[model samples]
Target: MPQKMVEKIEEIAEGSDDGLCDVIFHLKSQDLTLTHVVNAGGVAFRNRSLVTSATELLPPSLEVLRERQPRTIRRKTDRDAEEPSFASTIARAPISASPLEETIARNYDRLATAIASAALRPSVERVKDRTKDRFRQYRPAVLWSSESLRVALRRDDLLDLRQRTDFLASLNDVYPNQQVGVPRYFSPARSSAKVQGELSRVAWGVERVGAPAAWGAFGHRGAGVRVAVLDTGVDASHPDLKGKIKGWAEFDGSGAQLPRSRPHDTDRHGTHVCGTIAGGGHSGQFVGVAPEAEIYAGLVLNGRKGGTVAQILAGLDWAIEQRVHVINLSLGGRTLERVVRSPFHRSLFHAASIGISVVAAAGNDGSQTSGTPGNDFFALAVGAVDVKDRCAGFSGGGTHLITESEHIGPKLLPLAYSKPDLCAPGVDIRSTVPKEAWGFLSGTSMATPHVAGAVALLRSACQGFSDLPGFRQSSVIQDIILATTFDLGERGLDHRFGFGRVDALRAIDAASGWVTDTSEYRDRRNRSPVAPPSARGRLGRLPGIGPADPGA
Candidate 1:
């Protein structure tokens, strides 16, 4: 190609249109390297299949996000080494303060608490309560005591960030007993490697998680309950995934639905994850964890062109609106982002509080690595396990824990579980692809759907589960899922195995009374990681994701 054409191509490729870099690179066995990337929550444009961020249904803040503004704009030297961290603030009504109080919560019952504490506070900036009006739609769902509140804020300028940081410094002295919120982000948890498995017997991943047993032995196949797969859009026309799609939609950066879900699957991530969750086994070559379950598919990622955090939050918000019983997020970005933001985390907690079980893939960033929403407190993070039940090399975990999650599980998990909530089959997993094809993929992404499908089956087996009190249904479901796991890795909740490999059969059996100890599933609200005394404004080195550049 001529030099002018090459420069023109570079310009267009580097320029993002509506959140997509739209790079068209031609490598005739000569080209070398390239790059670029992008997350979901919400229901706007009630009837329209797709809506933009500025759509009337979206909150004011989402409009800003839809523009895909830079994630942070700081001087090169000022930027800290990016590390993934985000804070989710879950609150109810305020309690009487005393020496006995271990932490302080922002607001008792208002959606504005998270924003005000971080940026709207009088001490932080002159912005004051003005910022809260922009994000009232992002409030938490309260079940037992009061509503939950989780918020995310943007620093429009150096002065804005300066005020926020200065306030963070005195957080210890300001509210000695309260927990400050953490900023959060969302990324895709890339896929796994392809390996050979028995084409005849049940798909190894399905068998490994005992999906067949949940079907044949108990006659449970995730009926009634609905599960959502938030990833690259699914190939709705695939034979196995045909009628399984109860509802599906695509979203742009700002959480608005797409015009309509495409029958094509340029990105097979969502299709494969859906197949693992509830493929109809049209080819008889692959089986899903919950074949009879209803599916709610969201195309958060746009094929190879990466998506943005706004896109993800919108999908999540929509799934909650759709009242999905379980949601599986098989995508994520780096586990090393500097500032850990948790608007995504708070949304997950809000979804869970409303009885929606969320499962996310631990990123592929290997051991001791963690990232965005997956590392958030509320998301049930799943790690990848090969057919041999060994943790996948790319599974991300082992850094820090959400203070709230530290007290979850039937038993107290070891601190190593700062990342992974558990493990499931992800290696060499065979499932439906686009154009009626079947393919094998591996990653924590694949492992996530297994758990999500399991959640559906357990919900199907349990009667009157929905009638349970707020947080009770999700808590019981979580308990059954965690306690039934077959132990592995370090004899306890190691970074890799978390609560150990998932046992779908055991979970359903205990949940449906095939086994005893139904009481083990009770909700234990012991630890409050949110609004805790020492929780700081979870800050990190903001990278190119912010203002200076619309993250490449």
Candidate 2:
């Protein structure tokens, strides 16, 4: 811990009430159990079985939750012309044959016993291991991460723990778990206005992205692909969403998975997002991009400021169990931090490693603003555009600095990449709402599902193609979408519109005609400086992942 940071933590604690503060500890080893960590004096949060639920769902181990980290692109040096592109730098590790449900069931008893025993008084032998119980006064409720390599807990003595050198040195890193919400726009009245009557026409957004063209060409409305929406929840009974839902789950305030939870929305945000992804025809109008895709709704947010980061991770863990092809995150937090150290970022990385494409909302905060998980390298960040294909003023955009972090890397040099990987129609978009009604909403939140649904469609179109796993891979899909964009901002990749507004028709075409050689696809992408000359040009000239062009 740096001395300046220690002072800052104490300073923040000075004016705060004595409520529990959420903290995440990044462990060095995944094998350390709750009892081992607590007995080793590594956790500042004391065991409080009464405050924590015994019925908490056990998180999976790192072996199940994470695949190996994907290789990332770095700055090109004079002697590095032959260097490989980050898109296919390393081969993907095979996903476990064991389903997430089986893994969870198998580890349930081990974690239950560990948590129960850790709550008891420290044994004489265990007590002898530490000099003293410095964190004993703090009765914090702890939650084990799905990866099991990290532990998140709520403690009342945040100020006290940071000052103790012994406690701080036990973990690799620590992060504050803050509640994040859907992007907020300036004119909230218009962005969230609930229109009176349902519009019986296809949304302008669905038309603008050319989703209909893809549907016509491929004859696949994302039938075989599965997508997960982690948000407030969804309105399962909405007219357009009746048969779209396949699975549902919710995380309580304490990050525990509630058993027998039904599909319901605490707010209208989740329902609308889900509708945009796969909503079927309502009032004779088709509103969804991948109307035939299966939907998995996970309620991680409850329309309040109290929703913690742990809930999101739990939802992500559950999504993996469903073997979803795409994940729609219509919510995120705005921050200017250059490095990625958050648990959600790690989960996104793991999701990408296992061939799950994640679409996130660039914050509604305008230019120069960056949002976590969205701005994260692992995500396919999306921005909002209007009917005219103009980037929304509230859409977040900027060049994010990818610096070395304990979780991400020890890089030779920091890499800068333009954010909001692409854009989609968000202004005045109409979709489903709660109480089996329909409404209009705006913001990058509305735009994210447009892209998520596009990924589902691509996955569905490319089904049975074994060689182009790159087509299903996050980085490759990200590059392909960027390559096929309609170029909304500047000439090339820029801060506002990234590569540009997403073009689903062109993206699907590129994916369909792409060379079956996945490695060759990566090699060709590395050599091309500009996004291959649009869909009109030769299909062989596809895009690659690298630093933004210096001139652009």
The candidate that wins on TM-score is 2
Worst 10 residues of 1 by lDDT: 33-42
Where does candidate 2 have its weakest 10-residue lDDT segment?
42-51
**Decoy 1 TM-score against native:** 0.60
On lDDT, the candidate that comes out on top is 2
Model 1, residue 376: displacement in angstroms? 1.3
Which residue ranges in model 1 land beyond 4 Å of their true spot? 1-201, 260-263, 337-340, 401-417, 514-552
The alpha-carbon root-mean-square deviation between model 2 and the true structure, to one decimal in Å, is 12.2
Local distance difference test values of all predictions, in order: 0.54, 0.61
Model 1: per-residue Cα lDDT over 18-98, one tens digit each: 322211111111101000000101000011112111111111111221232223212323221111111000111011121
Model 1 gets an lDDT of 0.54
Taking the tens digit of each residue's C-alpha lDDT, what string does model 2 give over 1-552? 456446644554554454444444443323322222112111101111111211111111113223334232243442111212123232222222233355455444443443344322232223223324633322222333233222222233455556556444444455555566645633234532222232235566776676665665566788978899999999999989998899899986545688988999888889999999998665456678888999999998887553667677778878876778889988888776655444565466556545688899888888988677788756788999876677889898787664543332343235456677678888888788888777788889999999998888887887533333422255456546666677665765577886677777767666664534344333333232123334223222212211121111
Cα misplacement distance, residue 473 of candidate 1 (Å): 1.1
